[model samples]
Target: MCTLTLAWQVFEDAPVAVAANRDEALDRPAGPPDVYRASPLVIAPHDVEAGGTWIGVNEHGVFAGITNRWTERDLAGERSRGLLVADVLETTSAADAAAHVERTTSEHEYEGFNLVVADAEDAIHLGWDGSLSRTAFDPGVHVVVNVGFDETFALPAERRDLGERQAESARAVREALEPRDDERVEGWLERAGTVLGDHEYGVCIHGDGYGTRSSSLLAVGERTRYEFADGPPCRTAYEPVGIEGQF
Candidate 1:
């Protein structure tokens, strides 16, 4: 996933709410969100090229998403970062998942990435820009893009030329999201999808060889709901992802 908004422990009923858009090559083959594992109940859209997922949630109420950091260097990892996302879903909690990342990245090399792992009780953000650094959220709304997680989009001057499009996109989305953070209310996830689909913000790109491919909205808690769109949210309709007894 290239762009995402996470509301961790921000709701009375839903402790973990998420909205994300997966940006990728137009020709890249991918399957819609589905149960990939039964043991721990993993549900996510699968990247056919890598057999991994860019985002997902598990029975444990653990949510994971990744955004590739902007860089001129080639992605050198032997393993796809999406696979790491899959491995994390197997973990029981956010802390365990954070440790998994710490240990795994120490032994393996991967492209620059920004990752978020959260549960009802705990949440963490891992920024991997050559080297990995970890952080904890203070319980509220947050935005993450190719530049990594931030309370607000602070476009780096050095990267503006190379990543301004995505950076500006995040800025626009953040502008739309500021109210939710200030008022401390609900429904931000669905509203996030609406803004993501808006062309003005550049969140939904068209006529571009590479752009948003799919979108997802999820609520995790005593009652969990998941919705997904096979194509860009701009023109495609979203369908509910059934997780009947999984969670």
Candidate 2:
């Protein structure tokens, strides 16, 4: 995943809402959403090469997703970061998932990554780049990209700003998350797609063989509803995915 925006306990009724754009080379092999009856009972899309996932939700109501962190060093022979998302999905709580990532960073040499793990009650943001740190989400919206969490919205320091492209993308997503009176989850999902399709900020990045491959929208409350678009949101419509057996 590249650009991720999460709304946590920000809406009156919905406790969690997530919009993510997975940016990668167009040739990478991946599948749409499905139920995996593995140890943690996952519901996620699959990455064929690494046998892992970019985003997923487990039976325990734990939602896990990962964003690559920009770095020049390549730690060869390390585990795939996609596998980290899969492993964290097996945990019961957001805290446990964060801890699971912390443990892995301590024992292995992997590339940089920013992970977001959440449940109905809380969300945990973990960043690993030779070191690991955990941050709990406040009752509001937050955005994370390859540079880590964007603190410019919460803090006034210029140093907290994200990269130019990422900052622009975050602004677009934030505008899309403005309050809407409609109570239907579908409305929010549609707005999420709009944010993903916004090209002004590169939310739907594409050029020179790399681009946004898939988009996902998730709403978790009394029930979890997920919508997935197989291709870029600019050209694809999100289809309702059955997540009954997943949780």
* 38-115 per-residue lDDT for model 1 (tens digits): 889899888899878988998888999988876556657878898999999899999999999999998888887888
> Whole-model Cα lDDT per candidate?
0.81, 0.78
Over 1-247, each residue of candidate 2 has an lDDT whose tens digit, in order, gives 3888887876555577888999998998998999854776788999987788999887777888888875445555288998889888888988888888888888887777888998768888987766777889887778888766756422223434445557666766776676576445557667777878877657887767888999999887677888999999898888988876455
What's the count of clashing pairs in each model shown? 0, 0
TM-score to native of every candidate shown: 0.90, 0.89
| Candidate 2: stretches off by over 4 Å | 72-74, 152-162, 181-184
